[model samples]
Target: MQANSASGMAVHDDCKLKFLELKAKRNFRFIVFKIDEKIQQVAIEKLGDPNETYDDFTASLPADECRYAVYDFDFTTEENCQKSKIFFVAWSPDTARVRSKMLYASSKDRFKRELDGIQIELQATDPSEMSMDIIKARAI
Candidate 1:
């Protein structure tokens, strides 16, 4: 019985390794956007001195399978250096069907505008709500 259990464990490990190898060989790719310092400055400048705090800006959008937006912000401060916050936004597709799609600039707007592009067939979509963790994982 002990030998049989050991063999089962080895088989499981081998299956996992084979699955990983097949995943690596696939043509899976994710879109990457770099939030440069200049873009961060622009977004903050546009936001201005609003009464709302960072929490207010982080609220999820209330929409169906319509246009959706996501904001990612990072704050950093160093000794004797000015504190700064960076922001990025991504928009979802306009179709009634919920699915993940590539985002592109909708216009020359400085508000980090986003528009839907081609849809990724294998990507999952959350109609219940937009989740940062899920989006980041899928993007990766």
Candidate 2:
């Protein structure tokens, strides 16, 4: 029965339920909602956009497995709704225990550049196209 906090306002359970339903209807799912500040910092630093800051992100993991993940980053505020930048990652299968080698980069352009010559198990704007293929996915 914990209340959700947004902009210091106490949002009740009913509102939370409705929000979840709406997200589902939109084909959106959260992979890791609250990324650690350090991770965010490192990602931005490595991505070469040091000044950009994102409060949170929503990802489409699609299948129960974390084979391929696509994320959209944004800063949520009442004054602005800046969004639509995407980050994608390909995770190593659990049997390999190589999740630590997960590779992530932003935008399809960068995704192509960074992951070039590296075989991708899946690639599409639609998450429904992702699969469980894990071969040749040398994690960065």
Candidate 3:
């Protein structure tokens, strides 16, 4: 899998981390996990195949204060036609119904922006440090 870097360099199997800025002042982030051999062996013995689906891995995750959503997105470019990077966005499930709605609204807003030709930049970054213009320019 080829990764698209802000510097225009290609990285293979790069782990993606994502963060979202919520209006409620709570921070949310997700990290793409790489399940190694040891974990796989253990899972095969105790649980089913962890590699089967993200849901399998999610089931193993210890319950936390937050809920979660695990999914991957395929990213491809003309220069990297031979491969596509699967970026995982593991969103924590919010217990508060209002906050849950807010999260959905934020995602909807992002999609709308993309449809309008606006850049969708959910970087693994401090919201204060993120520059929408810079992220938008990187797409070009």
Candidate 4:
């Protein structure tokens, strides 16, 4: 694990590898990450399948926890062209503990900086904030 000295948080190598596989090879529909404060490291928590729906991606996120996720979103343009975009999400639900929220917040940049090729970024404290309607609106 390589740590970001500024944040005193380490990002596991698998996080980057998984991100690359998703970004370059489209191996996953989305990827979820969590921070272990005791270990001061960011690690992969789950990987969504390429065929999974957007609802599946959102369902994987806990209702009362903080997480960082990357999603590969596919959509059709008004002109009927198929397109895909990568999204980086910072999930800090309102029901989560303050300590957990703060830790995830402070360490976000360090972890996000490791995943490249992200075209959009969304930070949400509630499910509605990252709803599919909002996602599609932004994607379009």
Best by lDDT: 4
lDDT of 2 by residue, 98-122 (tens): 3222322222233233222222333
Residue pairs with colliding backbones in model 2 are none
Cα RMSD for candidates in order: 19.7, 16.8, 16.7, 0.8
Residues 24-74, model 4: lDDT tens digits: 899999999989889999999999999999899999999999999999999
Local distance difference test, each candidate:
0.27, 0.29, 0.28, 0.92
Report clashes for each candidate as comma-separated counts. 0, 0, 3, 0
Model 2, residue 130: distance off in Å is 19
lDDT of 3: 0.28
- Output the better candidate (1/2) by TM-score: 1
lDDT, residue 3, candidate 1: 13
TM per prediction: 0.27, 0.22, 0.21, 0.97
Off by over 4 Å in 3: 1-50, 66-84, 96-140
How far off is residue 38 in model 4, in Å? Answer: 1.3
Off by over 4 Å in 1: 1-49, 63-76, 91-96, 99-140
Error of 1 at 35 (Å): 22
User: How high a TM-score does candidate 1 get?
Assistant: 0.27
Clashing pairs in 1: none
The regions of model 4 sitting more than 4 angstroms off are none
Q: Which pairs in model 3 have colliding backbones?
A: 67-92, 67-93, 68-93
Q: Per-residue lDDT tens digits of candidate 1, residues 49-131? A: 22444335333322322222223222333454442222223434355333223222322132222212322212213332334
lDDT of 1: 0.27
What is the Å distance of residue 55 in model 3 from its true position? 2.4
